[model samples]
Every structure is written in C-alpha cells, then in structure tokens.
Target: MHRIAILLSTLCCAVTLMAQPALPPVFAQTDAARMRADAITRFYLAPVRVMQSHGATRPEVLTRITNGQTELGRNGMCLLSNAEGDTASITLDYGRELHGGLRLTLGSSSRPEPSLVRIRFGESVQECMSDTRNTKPCVGYSTDDHAKRDIVVEIPRDGQMEIGNTGFRFVRIDLLRTGVTVAIKEAAAIFRYRDLPYVGSFSCSDSRLDSIWLTGAYTVQLCMQEFLWDGIKRDRLVWIGDMHPEVATINAVFGYSDVVPSSLDFACSEFPLPRWLNNIPAYSLWYLIIQHDWWMHHADRALLERHRDYITQLVDQIDLTVDSVGRFRANVFLDWPSSADKAGVRIGVQALTVWSMDAAAKLCRILGDSAREDKCRAVARRISSHIATPKKLRQAAALMVIAGCMDAGDMAERYMHGIDGFSTFYGYYMLEALAMAGRYDDAFDAISRYWGGMLDLGATTFWEDYDPAWGSNANRIDEIGDPARKNVHGDFGAYCYPGFRGSLCHGWASGPTAWLSRHVLGFEVVQPGCRTLRIRPHLGHLDWAEGSYPTPYGAVKVRHERTAGGHIKTTILAKPRGVKVITDR
Candidate 1:
C-alpha cells in the first residue's frame, strides 16, 4: 500500500509538470483589426444631415468649419447664420490644435437652387471658398452609392466663411469636431410636407433628424406591402434596424432599445421606441457579441468570459420560462416593454439564440474549458434541433444562415402564397440561409421570383417592402408623416431620385444587392480595408453593370460576363481572407 501511494504521488507530480504554460492574450491581428474597424464603420454607417433648399427661396450663409476653428474643433461643427435678410455670415471654427480637420459636404437639392456664394477664411487658412461647381448636388433616388461631394471643407485656423446671395434653406455640415454649431441668422425654410403622416418625428435631445428619416417612411409602406422586398436589402435574420440613422441615434443616446434598463440615468420615456416596441437587452447583447465575432472573424474568449456570468444568468432565467417550442410559455401573450413580438417563435428569435450559444461554445473551446464547451454545445444542439426542421421554422431558420444554402427541411415552397410567403419579411435572410444550408435550388427559385417581380415593377432601386414576388401593397412608406417629428422618409429627400422625385432608390436595400453582386457573381474584394473590391462578376439580367466604389482600404470595381452554365465565375481583385477563412456553412 505504501509503495502504491508513492507511485501515485510521483505520477501526479509528473503530470502536473508536463502541463503547458498559459498562452498570453493575443490581440487581434492588425489586418483583422482593420477589417473589424471597417465592418464596424460599414455596419454603423454614419448618417449625414444637410439643409435641403437653403439657397432656393431663403437667403442663407454656408459656413465651413475647419478642425481648428469649430467649438469642439476637428471640424466637429459648422454654423450657418442667415443674416435674417440680405446678408449673412456663416462662421467656421476649429477651436484648437488637438482637434483635427474633417471633410464637410455642402450642396443644393437636385433641382438647381442658384445662389452666388463666396468663401473667406483667416489669413493663415487656405482654400476658404468652396467650389460649388464641384459639389455634386445631393441628387438621386439612392444616396447609398452617392459620393459625399457637397461642401468639402477642412477646418483651418480660427475663422472661415462662405457667404451666399440667397437665404439658404438647407445646409448639411458633417460632424468634424466636437460642439459643431450651425447658427442661421436668417429664417430657415419650412418644408412643404412638414405635417404629413410619417413625415418626420423622432430624434435625440439634440433634435437632429436622421438622414434616413425620409427613406424609412417611404420604405415602411413597401415593407408592410411585401416583407421580402425590404428583406432583400435588410437581411431579415440579422439586426439591420440598428443601422438606421434615427434608430442608431436613439439607441446610442437612449441606450439600445432592449438593454436600456441596465444603464443608469437613462429615462425610459426619453427614448422614441416605446418599451413595447423594442427588443430585450439580452437579445441585443447576445446578437452584438455574435455579430462582432462573425464579422470580425474571431472569438474574444476573455471578453466573452468577462460578460459570461451576466449572459449566463440572464439566459438561464430565460430558459426556465421558455417551453420546448422555444416560446416563453408563461409570458407568451404578455408583451415586454418596447418589445416587438410580431414574429414570435419564428426563426428570427431562435437564430440569434442558437448563434449566441454556438459563439459561446467556440469561446469555451478556445479558452480550454472543455466542460463549459460541452455545456454550450449541448445547448446549441438542443436549440438547433428545436428550431431547424419545421416547414415555416426551417424556411425561417434557413434565412437566418445568410449563406443561401438550402436543405431537405426547407419548405419555402410550402409557405409561398403566390405574391407573399410566410417568410416575406426576410428576403436577404432567406437567400443567405438557403445558401448556407446548401438548399441552392430553393434559394435560386426564390431569388429569381423576387428579382423578376422587381424587374416587372420598373424598379431602379429596390423598394423597402414587397411580397415574395414583389407584388401586393407595394407602396414604400409608413402611414405616419409629420414635419414636426424626426421620422424617416416623411420629410427629407435623401432616398429620392436626383433629390427631387420620391422613389425607392434606397441606400440600405442596396447593401444586400452589393453582397449578391459579390457572392452570386463570384466577385471577391481582396484589398486590406477594401474587402468589398471585385474583379470577376456576373449579372443574371441587365445590359452591362459596372461601378467602382471607394472603401476605407481602396477602390473596388465590379463587372459581369454571362456564361453557358449560368453560374458566374468570380475573380477577386484582392484576397479578402487574411490568416484564416470562416465558413459558417
């Protein structure tokens, strides 16, 4: 017995000595970090606001605030003062040296609003006069692809000025420095549809209208008419609403609709989305982490662990109440504050839940916590099993995948109602999930149906809403429009074609099309920050489509060539995948 005990002790000591030392936390690679930053910026595209008809009817001053003269400096603010009559001075200040200069755009609406304007600046400053001829009027049905060529101004020293003959009705100054102020000495021009339904309402205490306010209202109608139309652009399975200007502003200022409770000093009433219309914080938190991981192409285990307890506890409490079908049985009918439960028990909720668990499991594996990994895996399997097989559920879940893969469980055909489908609200999601799941045929059929329908409608830019076939209540707007409120698409002309006509050339919906142009056309972006570049491309329809875009890294161009096989062979200008490639499929 003594000999056996000694041997056991020796073995234990040897095993302990053989263990490897802990590895230090490796910060994300520079390229990865750059990619992540790019994704983050794109994911949260900053909305630019400007005066619409400043020079048309009213006399106004166009101010260019450089990074050096603005109150917060860094071109953070620009002040446009309407002299209240014949003359006005637009003051531009960048305040201090610590602040850097940023680009600002100034322009008239698409319809020419002529005004003789002059540029002036401090003695040390250069390029005080903005070249109105070069400023591309904020025109076009779709501003998504438009360049920011309006008033390109850099904050120089203490003073910069741009004066115009007409009282300006609209002026858009980019946030270049902190406390960027625009004071109009003249009376601002009033909008014609200021009191229409869904026109304008909603903003932070600062009362800045989101760039998408007009677009949202215009698209809301279409979304209601046919869900997938918007889905094609928004990606139903993902949280695209967070990208809207008003939505972003509200969430940033008031706290994300779901998790506002966690943050103190946030008055719930201060937010626009009532508690009843918002999502649960846990959902947002989980989705945020998963999104970060998916787009950034990495798992931050330490970060995950830091929030593990809170996430785990909240999920645990949630699970206790949810039934086998994934419904909150106890509060099934009882709605939470600011929560939207329109698609209850559908794949939308399940997809996020499953994804979060899957992500957690990945983190656990990376952290060398086999036990926790097992736990997360088991939960993931359970959720997947419950969510993936039903006709409606499967189609919905497939959309959640975003890879456009399809499988046996897919029942998109079963849910099709000619014009609308059970999954209409999630167009892009349907394509992505079907692709990821390898349900290529179904995904193709659905895309064809949607594309054909849009073509039939003479759609230059995709609408915000539509049925499975782009038919039905095809109007692209919500019922609410009032100039007093900061509503999307109700009052502004951002989504209008050439900034004059109301139409569906929307920026948000175009993003998905860009993805398809890359994915289906097989075009890949290879540059470092230019992850969206394209070399090889194919378009199913249209004479010839070619366009170049400026990305953080560089420029990308997309071109397509038809082939007999009908499948596009793509060539990437650069390699998008850096150290590793992630295949969710």
Candidate 2:
C-alpha cells in the first residue's frame, strides 16, 4: 500500500510539473538603464532660436523670413510694424522645425497706452501666414490686455490656450490693434526634446534614399519631445498604435533613451484596467510589443522589474478578452482608410495578441515568474491555432508573419507578390515583416515604390497617409474621378479637417530610417544594449553602403561594397570592445 501511494504521489508531482512552463534563460543584470537615463537628462537642453522679422508679402511669405545670424539669448529686440494700412505681420523662421515652448517678450511702451497683439504659429511657411479662421490645423493666440511693463504670454497650463509647445518652423506675429506700436524684444522659442546624440548614420549610391533617410530622421526627431508624439502639428499626444513604429525607429536612430520607458509608463498609468489604450485594443497589445522590443534591444532588467506588477495586470486584462475560440472581442483599429473586413480585423487582433503574449512570456521568464509566462504561452498557442486565412488582410497577414504566427519564408514570397493595399503607416510593419521573411529584394522594392512614390509627389517630409493613386497632387480626387478641387478639404480625419491638415512630417511614417540601418546596413542588436551584434549585410542592387549604429558604449560603423567579381565584401570600421558580431551571408 505504501509503494502504491508513492507511485501516485510521483504521478501527481509529474503532472504539476508538466503543467508549469519553462522559464526564459537567465540574463545578467546591468546598470545600463540608469546610465542611459542620466545621459539623456544631461543632454536634454534645447537649442534656442531667436530671429528678427524681414520684409513681408501679401500671399506667400516663404521668401521673406530668413534665419537670423544673431545669437539666441534674452533681451534681444526687434520692431514689427505695418505700412500703417494693413495688419502688421512679421514672420520668424527658426531654420528647422522645432517642438517646444515659445516665449515672446513684449517690450513695454513708455506711453500709458494699452495695445492688443495677436500671434500665429505654423509648421510651414504658408501655414504661418494663412488666415487662422479658414485654416483647420492653425495654432495661434490673441491677447487684448496691455501692460505697462513687459508681459510674457505663454500657453496656459489649464489647456485654455490653443497652442503650446507644438511643432513649428515659422511664426507670424500680427499686431491686431491698428496704429499701436509694440516693440517685440526677445522673440525666442525654447526648443524642448530628449537630447539624443545622432549616433546612427547612413549613405549609399542612391542619393534619393539618403535624402529620404535624412528627412525621415528629421521627422522622427521632431516627434521626440516630452514623449513620442504622432506629429508636431496635430495630435501631439502619445498613441500606442503610432508609438510602436516610432519607438522602433527611435531605437535604431537614437539608441535607447529614457523617453521610451517613461512614455510606456505614462501610457500604462493613464489608461488603467479594462480601458483600451487610446481606445484601441491593438494599441494595448502594441504596448507589450514595444516593451519586449525595449528589453530585447536595451536589455534593461531594471525596467522589466520596475513594471513587473503593471505588466502582469496588463497581461491579465488581455487574457480576459480572449474567447475560448481564440477570437478577441474589443475595439479593432488596423489603419486608416479601413480596408480590412471584420474577419480580417479579428485575425489581425488574434495575431497581435499572440505576438504580445509571446513578448509577455519572455518578459515573465526574465522576471522569474513562471506561472504568468506559462499562461501567456498557452494563450498564445490557442490564439495562433485560430488564425486562419491571414492573406485576407494585408495588414493582418504582414502582422502574422511579424508576430511569428506564420512562417516568414513561406509568407514573404506570397505576400510580397501582391502588396496592393498598404499605407505609409502600415507599410512600416510590412517592410519589417518582409525583412524577417528574408525577402530583402522585395523589401527594397517596396521602399522604392512606396516611400519613393511619396518623394516623387514632392514630399519634403513623410506624410501621415499616402495613396499612390492620389499622385503628386494631394488636392485632386483622381481615384474617385471627381473634378479637381483646389484643395482636399472635407476629408475624414487629418486629411483636411482644418486648413493645413494631415501631418506632413509624421514620426510613425519614418520607418525607412530604421529599415535601412538595421536591414540594409545590417546593424542589428542580438543582445540587449548591443552586447551581441548580428551583421547580415543585404545590399540589394546597391554598389556600396555605409552606416553606423549607436550602442551604449560607442558606435558600430560598417561599410559594405559589391566586388567586380560579384562577391560582397564587408568591413567593420569601429565597434565596442567585447561585443560579438555575427556575420551571415
């Protein structure tokens, strides 16, 4: 009887052990996160721009304002006046785009007279001078009160002011009160952004790609303020869906910065249990995916430990939404223009859930929480089993491949052959999925076709949404066969809601910077903080390519060239000591 009891006990113990999942491999802890945070804080100082008004024009003021040669500091003075008939306007150009606070020191007049002043802000030259009443996305402020002393008008903290630390390259200060002399002293914009070194660099045979890379890099830089904003002009708030791609691009370009973790924490804290992030279910999953990417690239154990409980609770919330059949029931938001059907959205959600769970499982293992990790893997398996007909939705299919729900090699060929419905936003992930599937040629072609198309349309910076059929003219309705309109107003969302609508320099659309550096130049992070590196150079159709990726310790420089005999030669110019570089053909 004792022997029989022992056998039963052993069986029970084996069953319990089998039910539990295996933990992830142990990784050594480091102070990289703290060090990065400190470095970022020290470099967070914004470059100031102080410019005086030049000559003014009636319609297009693009030619009037030039960047002042004077040094930016307090107590600077510039006189802005009208010809005595029309509204007095002075345009100030900051040279490049900036996202930060604007301070205009209004010089107090010696006379005891009250004067009203109106100030307008814009991200473009036309936007700066355009009438705010018709302009949909116009940002400006007007004040009626006049003080005897210098008065500083700021974007109020109570949200009463329309414009604050927003994105702008030009400012039009209009004197509203006629015949009132107002001396403007110290017209300065305090630029605020996470001070990150330009560690990543890229140049190739294609000058257009180089230009696109620089433009994309600038676009991403403008969006990196207190948090990862969608755009500088509009919706300057953190949306997890937009943030997923933005964060990836930031990682490749800026390396690991404190803004990323702080942004994640802010998103998680703002939206508690049961509420979807930014009211989108996929956004919530994207939060987890971003967390996984951060840990994988930076290897910040302290970050994982800091948010362990919050991560567990978030995973629990996700678990509650999954049905027995592996279908997700929540708000489904894929991308703009809404191409995906109901079934396709469900499949996309399922794939994203699987991806997030996989990430959560790794995170849980890293945190030494076997129970949640096991649960995450089991749920991911269940969801993966139900993902049928991934090809129905291009976004869904691409995401499935990215999430490891489908074989990248098999899907890459099939998906790359027909990429009919892809916007700039979703195109970012599509390129990533293509690269993962080893379809380097297709990825290159897609970038040339999609992003290149945007360039052909005279896009100085990447846009929020782009349709090839729309052609070079954004105002025309060629797809619908309607008569050409002066401007595409009355469109949905940011298309033309306000005048100067649709973010011209969107951060999420800056995927080519990350793709080119990580894939084409082949500077990938194998271990967190780049302790291990993977150098797989795929210079498709390019004679030569050179770039550098920033690491915690230093920059890793690489140069690749195709030999005359059709052999590819690669050279690592510089890299951190003790870092592993795995070269793959």
Candidate 3:
C-alpha cells in the first residue's frame, strides 16, 4: 500500500509540472554588446533649456516682475518676497515641453540662518498649480526630509544644486520660511534625449504646414529620450505599438541612431515568451516589424546578427499562437480606442500577424538564412490565404495592403475614402498605404484634411487623437459618456484616465513630418543608410516644396515646383558623392 501511494504521488507531481507554461529562452548579452550599449548611452547627453519665464500667484506681484531678456552677459533672475504670505511661489517655463532634471542657482540673503523651501514640477502650467489630490503623478520636493527629497542638498545657500529628472515644461518654487526671501539667479532644465543631429527639413507655400512639420519634429525629439518613451507626461515607457510609427519617423529625421537598436534589444531582453511585451500580443508583433524596419534603414548587420536567436524565438512564439484557422489567439490590441476583446478576433490582428511573419521572412533573408527565410514565407503565405475579407477599419485594410495580403488597388478605394472613426495613430498606416498604392493625390488630400485639420484647431504640436468635428472644445465627451466635467481638456477613461488625461503632445501622432518629407517631398531610402536615394516629388496643390534628408554619408537636398503646364520641375540642390539619385516623374 505504501509503494502504490508513492507511485500515485510522483505521477501527480509530474502532471503539475507539465501543466505550467514554458518560459522563453534567456538572451545572454555578450560583454562587447553590453559595452556598446553603455557607450551609446554615455554619448547621448541631454541638452539644456535655453529659455525661461517667471510668474507669481498675486496679480500685482506678477505684473511687477519683468520678462527677463535673453542677454549674452547676464543670467535670468526672479525674486520672491514673503509680503503676500509665509509661502510665495514662482513659475518657470522652459519654452517647450521636455523631460529632464532641473538645476537652480539660489542667491543667499544677508541672514546666515538656513530656511526651508518646497519645489513642485509639472508638465503644464495648470498641472503645476493644481492641487496634489487632482494630479496622477505628482512631483514635489520638501526640504524637511533631506533623505526623502528629490535633490539631496542644503537649502537657502548661495550655490547651485541639481533636482531629479521628471517630465515638465513648468516649475513652481514655494518659499516655506516666514519673513525669508530668496533670489533665483538662474534656472534651467537639462533636457534628456538621444542627441542625434537633425538632418531633415520641410518647407512649403503653406506656412502652417511648415510650422506643423517643425512642431511634429519637436514632439518626436521630446520622446526620443533614453529608450523612446511613448510620451513625456505619462506612460513614459517603451511601448512597441507606439514605437512602430516613432521608429519610421526617426529614420527620416534622426537617421541612424544607436537608440533604435538599443530600444529593440531592451524590449526583447526584458519581456520573455508566454508574456507579451507590455502584456499586449500585438505589441510583440509590432516589435518584429520594427526590427525589419531597422535593417532596411540603418542596415546594422551586427545588431541583427546578435539578436538572431532571440528574434527566431519570438517568431516561433507568435507562430504557436496561431491555430489551424490562422487567427491570433493571444491578446489583440489595435489602438487606444479599440476594444481588446473584440480586437482579439478581428481581422486587424490577423492582418498584423501576417505582416509580422512577412517582416520576419525579410529579416531572415537579410541574415542569409535561406532555410528560415523559406519557412517564414510559407507561414506568411498560409496566413495570407486565410484573410479572405479585410476589416472595415482603415488600419486593418491598410496593413493588408502593406503586407501584400490583398491587391492595393482593390482595398485602397474602400478604406481610404472616408475619415469616420479615423485616429491619428492609425492614420499613420493609412497614409502610408494610400501613398504606396500610387494614389499621391488621395494621400495629399488625407494629409491636408487629417493633419491640416489639427492645424485649423490652432494646434502648435500634434495631438494624441483628433476629430475635425470636435471643434474648439477640448472637453468634448467621447462615446459611452462618463460623468461630464466642465472645461476638461481630455476625454474621460472611466477612472483609468480622468479629466485632461490625453497627452496634448504625443510622439506617435507626429507622422506628418515623416509623411510630408518622405511622400510629398519624395525622399526615400532605396538601400540601408540611403546608399541609393529615390526622389519622386509629388507637389499636389502646393506651389512649391523643398526639403533635405539626412543620410549615413551626408544630406540630400531636393526642391520641387509646379509648372504652368501641370508638370513638376524637380531640382537636386545637394547630394553626397558616389550616391545614386533616382528621380521618378
């Protein structure tokens, strides 16, 4: 009886171990790769804020302060007195939104005694002044606790000190000591980002387009920090879905930066199998697509070779999720407004799966692995065969075309015509599909209507999502109405995201910069590092447009003007020597 009981117990234990899911293979980073990543991190130092502003709570005190000029000889200074109350606050603006640490030069008074002060940082003026209860991620420092404070230093001293990093365009300094005053001789923000040189420019007859391009470029720059954060304000992590569009835009503007491969490596290394990156399955697929993009533009063979085994593991993991019916069984995330439950079975996810498989095949081919390339292509073909009908959404249909699952002409007419339920994030893929289908006229119109609509609403930088009908009201309630709030700048998210939760300056929404520069200005990379350039200028309804695209070698400048006979007069202003410039009219 004892021997029989032992046998049953051992069988039960074995069954329990088999039931547990398998973990992904661990990717070991070589010492050389680790050193390379560390070197890249060290080379990309953050920039300093060149501008500043000052404001006070009291109207009279605010008016009394002068706008400090950006003079060469003197640093900007603002004084705070305790006449109003025991605590007085001064607001500082960095001119543009940024994510970084703060440094302030505090001037000492005649009194030798030290005084305590509290400083709060915010990404917006309203956020800085708002009560702590209302803010989600509140950032403030108190001198009372030296160890717990953001910056570890003595207060009320005539010296400069550094505050910890945060996402902010505004800073509020509160004087805590009664009858004590302090003069802020100088204040500046150390802007953190991957310091890549700007190599792209776009200008046109419409000054609004020019402003929009630059604003979008700046938004991209703000998000290109340590690891391509989704945005500066909130959820500042490397989300693969958001990084897809960001990587494309970075290719056109920043050229070949190490941040791209570093971000990809971080995602794959951090998230193992059976658990998707960010717990979203579609995001993992997007990461695969981004790897293909990195190879095509930057052509970093060493990086791709280093991550080959890890990439194969990811491809196999995704393949396992597909059943006989060719549907993705894991969590499907389309966009912000999409429903996860419904998106799981939707055609969008299937299309993305096929796209990812195709991308994997391309990467395998680049790596000279013919056997793996053939296997990937067979799987992609099998999945593409199952996509008989495309989803009604523009993003799904667009991805179908881009992945070569369907004829571009057939799907373009159905998806590209209407703007209903169109979002800026998905709009990026839709615009690319329209341009790829030889529909430059339609692509140009979509750009003007969708992106130009944002400009019409007085947008200095692109928004996370925009609808033309929303019209001057930032508080417009979305579908499934939650409790309405007056003067709220963002749509509600049912406690998940409260009032004014939408990011005003999002990174992925800045697709117009890439669209205008690549499609409209007709600058494309035929080979990685732009060894071969393709300039096919499409001046649709514009009098003229000119831009310069950065390459691994140098800059390639091009200009196009519409002639009276409806012909495009193209001119190549500058190009690197030995580089082939192919102009297609």
TM-score of each model, in listed order: 0.40, 0.76, 0.77
Estimate the overall C-alpha local distance difference test score of candidate 3.
Answer: 0.65
- Encode model 1's per-residue lDDT on 312-359: one tens digit a residue: 543454445445665433322111211243353344455555555665
Candidate 2 weakest lDDT stretch, 10 residues? 141-150
Per-residue lDDT tens digits of candidate 3, residues 71-163? 222133355566535566665555455666666655554356665666665544444444443435222211111111122233555666667
Worst 10-residue lDDT window for candidate 1 reads 38-47
Candidate 1: stretches off by over 4 Å: 1-348, 384-409, 416-425, 434-514, 521-568, 576-585
Question: Which candidate, 1 or 2, has the higher TM-score?
Answer: 2
Poorest 10 consecutive residues of model 3 by lDDT? 140-149
Q: Could you tell me how far off, in angstroms, the CA of residue 296 lies in candidate 1 after the best superposition?
A: 4.7
Candidate 2: TM-score? Answer: 0.76
CA lDDT for candidate 1: 0.32
Error of 2 at 245 (Å): 1.6
